[model samples]
Target: MESEELLGNLGQEENGVPKKEKKSPLISLEKDLTFYADSIKEVAVEIMMEGISLHPIFIAHQHEVSIGEVILNKADLNTDWTIQASTLEEFIQKGIIHPDKKEQFLKTYKKPENYMCVFVVVPQGANFVYYPYPKEK
Candidate 1:
């Protein structure tokens, strides 16, 4: 299928309104590094189990001072992973990611009002790690 067609499908909803996906409990104001990391891993494993070879992208959005949200997007499922991965690596090297809780930072980066930090989950041996995309100036 063409990329455009696939994107169109993603935007489609049964009724005009988009269906709400189950939000991950890991998104919150309190810091939980292990929980966030495990959540990302679970998402990747779930995708793999579904027979989807694409790597999942988890975009974090912080809508308020204390509230944050996470939305999962599949990078390889819709686009080229090589190009995306390279870009993300640059961001990580530049320190776009949070110093400690890298995955948790996503909650604030992809906010609905102001998008910032973006990251892609890359396979590292038997685990997954977040590779951030640089925030636009």
Candidate 2:
């Protein structure tokens, strides 16, 4: 009864199944991720073009964390991801990148003009990755 009240009353149960089908979590997560990527693509490009730094690093996270400016805030949506945009210089300033490792990161850094650097944070882990602007046709 409580569940029915929370989920809204479906017609009735038949053969041990509710009348209304519940959506799959995987499908919902996939949709949210797609929406997030589509919504942030343009903002990412603009961040790169601003000339703050040749390499702009973005963080896609679901929890509160230090560093970077929140370019996109979707906290109001339970399934959406929030994005924080930052540059290499800011990373160093924030102590995210130690001075010793700066050279190593720079050495392996891809062309900033061609790619948007993104640090994706998930329950599993986090990694620095890149995506191209002017998305393929």
Candidate 3:
């Protein structure tokens, strides 16, 4: 019996190794999404069971959180971040950050040290990474 293939043309060879894939825009998205979709159930289950860990950095920063916040998004710097949300709302509500720049600031909410990065879950079913604060002098 012949096996059916799921995508693109038949895999080709190059220099004795299988060639890399060339994806169309839609195919590119589907490939990425299909991979995640395979894990979505597991992720949902894990979130439901063990749940996510969070730190309350805002509690201490209180009325002065202009410095912003960060969280670890990858196992190491060599990898891209799995997530990178921010404390724009929290900071604004606390009067540490301004509301006008919320969208701009959130766009650049960066990831922190791999060892120190951890994410905070917002009420909107998203994440905002929270990293260990700098040590006081």
Candidate 4:
């Protein structure tokens, strides 16, 4: 690196200006017509898992997310696995993900004051969900 980084000052400057500031572009879920609609659930789950490997969301119930497979839990998901929403609802009386149902299964479980149901949150700002993982010493 050069001792003095300024070219305009010719080497007399003491402080160097930063390269640039960057901001992520805002996304509108409703109008976005690219690849986000079909991918919302998948991408959101990936964010929940904190950039780990991607796994299919395991409903942990009789009605499988995929055909032929029925049971998968957090522990069952591999370390490389990304987010996996609790299949907790599928087994319950009122199913969370039902076809033709207006609302998702957001009402069943009570959430702590600061947190939200993992299923409802978008992937963009969900660091809080994964922040507690591999808990500190």
Q: Considering every candidate listed, which one attains the maximal lDDT?
A: 2
Each candidate's clash count = 5, 0, 1, 3
lDDT of 4 by residue, 32-63 (tens): 21222233344435534664322222221211
Question: For this target, which candidate reaches the highest TM-score against the unseen true structure?
Answer: 2
For candidate 4, the C-alpha RMSD (Å) to the true structure equals 20.0
Tens digit per residue, CA lDDT, model 1, 17-75: 86566454334311332224444455545544665433333433221111112332223
**Candidate 1 local distance difference test against the native:** 0.32
Ranking by TM-score: 2, 1, 3, 4
Candidate order (lDDT):
2, 1, 3, 4
Global fold similarity of model 2 (TM-score): 0.60
**How much is 52 displaced in model 3, in angstroms?**
11
Quote the lDDT for 86 in model 4. Answer: 42
> Candidate 4: where are CA atoms >4 Å away?
1-56, 60-96, 100-104, 109-136
Model 1 segments beyond 4 Å from truth?
1-33, 64-137
Question: What digit string (tens of lDDT, one per residue) describes model 2 on residues 1-137?
Answer: 12232123233566888656555434443455466665556665676677667667877666655668787776665666677878888877766678799999998787655566777664434567665555566
